[model samples]
Target: MSAAIPPADESLYAPLQAAAWRLGHLGQSLDGFIGTAGGRADAINGPENLDHLHRLRALADAVVVGAGTVVADDPRLTVRRVAGDNPVRVVVDPRGALLPDHRVFQDGAAPTLQASLEPGPAPGRAERLVVARRDGALALDDLFAQLAARGLRRIFVEGGGQTVSRCLAAGLLDRLQLCLAPLLLGGGRRGLAVPEAASMAEALRAPCRTYAMGADVLFDFDLSV
Candidate 1:
């Protein structure tokens, strides 16, 4: 494990600080206003986030994302974070809708594990986790328990908005680190889109510290459960 995040408890059965759930907005303002690229507006959190994720990835055994994110971004979930062992890329596809050739499972970046409702006789040339679910939502609690048992105890829940919201509302997240971009969408997709925050202030809960990334203010919410 990386010597970065310390354990929050002793037993470590409950979940140690070794794991972190990174929830950030992929916005222009948030990027330009806070996290900058080479002293300029960082339209995204830039390498700062990549670096943070890297630290988390080094300690974590698996990195996860919702299928929507895969379809939308088609990200190649690899650990360019600072180099250690390459973490396993896990995708959540309840109905196996990731479209066989999205490039997320190609190129041999790392082993891509697909957890779906059906086995389908193939793990898409990667790894397969034929999990059962009721409403297509993978039994989150059970999945996490199994992941922990599989040595993926320190897990990172990287995501799409809905996925992040669901995981947090379920109280399954241990910590949430968000890098707030400066630009305001006013109406674009929100970086953090979940249930209605009781109020704006309540929504952007206090005790939440803010840091200046580049042009955006990094709002890190410590959702340590």
Candidate 2:
């Protein structure tokens, strides 16, 4: 049976219209795991959450994901479930591990950009975007600047945990949307892996609002404040 589609909440996504906005999203189980230890996460979220992700992609000027996500999910990163144009697809592959066969590289459904640490020919129809590395990680500032240079100011970081964690830790994301499913996985990949804080005072406490997406609950955090 097809899952119920939730109604769109305009107020929930009003912050995305801000100038130079950046939003990150992740859907995980109630127990705080995005996938199983063996890398199985085909159905972590319901159809309503998937529709929400497609809506974000449709609104974004560019949708970004880490190489790990592409390798695991092989997502096309297009706005198929909603009525909007597709955004530019970006993949962060600092190590240049992805091949030419990945769907995002060859789909040709939307313009694709491969952000890497070294300059090289892009695979398939994608373009190469050489980025700098800071502390052995892709420099988020440089990536954002490069994207902005191409008029991609409204960014969406749709991820596999590590990439979203990096943006959150760097304070680059203006907002974050975390959807929690009702299922519980005892042990698996974490949804968010930000750096550990030594004390409760060091923890991040942003103002947030919650919405019901069918059986899943979405927590929309306003981080720009």
Candidate 3:
């Protein structure tokens, strides 16, 4: 319904120009937890961060998420907090584990697509794109290829931890915008779990910039390096 993203917020996502740019984000606690052990994730960031999220969604061609996020949040994945057109919703549900009646599938605000291993009936109005399985898992390369073929570039990979972790581990993420809240979740879901560094020399390092968004601190990393 809206025409374009606001200029102020647009400045936050100017790096996403290419068709294959994959930017990921997660709202984590001080202890690096994205959600509780039982998959409960509520508002961790304040107004500014939420607006930032909507702006990111507005600029993206598609918003990608895993089946776990779909099942846990049932988010509409639309640009509602700001004025902009909603992006296409992409669900990486290789096993078709997400519920058919989820709100993401029911919402008619944006075009929805599900990438799965087995071709079957799509939930609601979503179109199913069968991604061939590799080693009994969905091949990230093939999935992105298919999405690119469909003209979906500038993807926003928003998360549950597993999805973000997989993308981070696979080196598929171009940029990472992490909003860290002050709260602490001592025994909750991790923000990211990748291969451990053997030593300080083998650690992953990248240029990062920080910003204060209300009560949260946003860290923007150039993961492409």
Candidate 4:
């Protein structure tokens, strides 16, 4: 069944309207694992939560993911489960290891942008965006600036753990939506890896709200505020 996200206050998204707003989304188990040790994420989220992801993709100007996620999931990254147009797909692949056969490159449902550290030709219908490196890694700030130059303002960072962690660490994430399933994966990849705080006061806190997407619980945090 399909589910609707609770209506957000207009002010909450006002900052996004002016420029590129990056939002991160993750679906994890009760124990806070996005994938199993074997790197499988097919059954992490239920139908409703899956629908919610599609809704997010539909709403955003671009859907971004890491190269590892594409290699692991081979997702189409389209708005197939929801009612809306597909957003552009942005892949952060510093090594240029992603193959042209990946579904996102072949589907052609949306424009694909590939960010690589070295200058090279992108396969399939994807456009190669050469990003500057800071200490031998793609500079996240430059990547966002390039996307903004293309007029892709609202971006959805849906990814593997490492990519999400990078965004959170860099303070590039303006909003976060974590949907928790009722299952527990004892050991696996974490959803987000922010720095640990010494005390509760030092912990990262943001204005948060919750909603029910069928059996799953969605926690919405407004980091932009």
Candidate 5:
């Protein structure tokens, strides 16, 4: 995903909406978060992030989530406001629980590709890819290589926490974007993973960048190059 910097990096212009999305999500919310405590909208789902996220949809080659994410979020995964073409949609539905009846499979824009370990093809027009794996999840290396072959640069790995944390723990993440909302969930759920690590440095280390958007702060993780 490396490239020469465009002159408009510091500001967003009308034509470069997609570019803006990629740069903006450089440090986005942790997992999924949105809105403030006192707001009418409440939940882990943050509607505030949607505007810029549209830009990200245009820039990414694919928007990926684990099946758990798809079932929980059921995101349309489209670029509603951005200028560029929509990215491909991918779901790591290892066991194929994300049925065709889901709205996601119904979207025809970029098309939804399910990367699973299931034996047969999924019904309907939804594409099925059998990824090699021991457990239900696809092998990370195989998944990325296939994506690369399809020219899916700057793939966005959205998540259900476990998948995102897996990418982090295996050092497969190129960048990490986290959004911090002002209010605390306290007992609901954490935004990132707390996998057992050998050391504190290992736990916290990544290439770093930061920025602000509305009431949220974003963190860009730079994994070792």
Candidate 6:
């Protein structure tokens, strides 16, 4: 049986009202793939789910994405689908893979912060935030502390799998919202690439709630619980 769709409003994001929180979101197919083999992931979810993403951006003090997402999508990361101020845009590019011409760096729609381990000139008007490397990856805890020092407490980790997965594994995400679309890509990129569990007993579990968003089903997991 199909689940009842909830009303589209601010109430849908009420859980984010906590004083300090980090939220990670991913939209994947029914088969647990976020994109196809060719790296096409545009519009995987329905319009309502897209609006939900924008709502998340609206509520957050900063919206973060990995360099891979910027290289692939070049999103502006603005709050256009809903009525709210655009949050500060943050790009995690530890390898310096992205060029300065990306939309997020060039658009100037909102303040942009490029977090990286390398020291270089920031593209366009984006500011450079030097981060440390731990175990060959950017230290997410250092990044979070820096962000908090900058008065960005409400964080939204909107991503292309690797970034979200790293945050999830590091115990940085307070909540995770996984939206599942009806379509299934037989073979493609997987979502939430966390470390393999030895058995079902070792699998990560959390208290969750469900909401229907148009044709997609949103799974809201409270990992902090």
Cα lDDT of model 1 overall? Answer: 0.59
lDDT of 6 by residue, 11-63 (tens): 55666777689999999998888877766577799998888888788888999
lDDT tens per residue, model 1, 1-225? 343432331222123344433332333453223212222222355565556556556656778877877776677766665656667777888777677776667768777788777777444566668775746477766666766767776677777656666677666775566666545544433344556767777664534555554554555565653
The collision pairs in model 2 are none
Candidate 3 off by > 4 Å = 1-11
Clashes of each: 15, 0, 0, 0, 8, 0
Q: Model 5 over residues 18-48: C-alpha lDDT tens digits?
A: 4212222322234443222232222442454
Rank order by lDDT, top first? 2, 6, 3, 4, 5, 1
User: Best-fitting candidate, measured by lDDT?
Assistant: 2
Task: Give lDDT: candidate 1, residue 129.
Answer: 80
Q: Which of 4 and 5 is ahead in lDDT?
A: 4
**Considering summed lDDT, which 10 consecutive residues are worst modelled in model 6?**
1-10
Candidates 3 and 4, the one with greater TM-score: 3
**Local accuracy of candidate 4 as per-residue lDDT tens digits, 37-79:** 7676978888978877887777788999999889889988988
Name the lDDT value of residue 146 in candidate 1. Answer: 64
Estimate candidate 2's alpha-carbon lDDT, on a 0 to 1 scale. Answer: 0.88
* Candidate 2 residue lDDT tens string, 1-225: 122233468687667656579999999998899888768566998898888898888778999999988888889998888778889999999977799999999989999999999998898999999999999989988999999999999999999798999998888999989999999999888889877789999987899999998899999999989
- The collision pairs in model 4 are none
Q: Residue 15 CA error for candidate 6 (Å)?
A: 1.9
By TM-score, the better pick of 1 and 3 is 3
Q: After superposition, how far is residue 192 of candidate 5 from its true place, in Å?
A: 1.9
Colliding residue pairs in candidate 3:
none
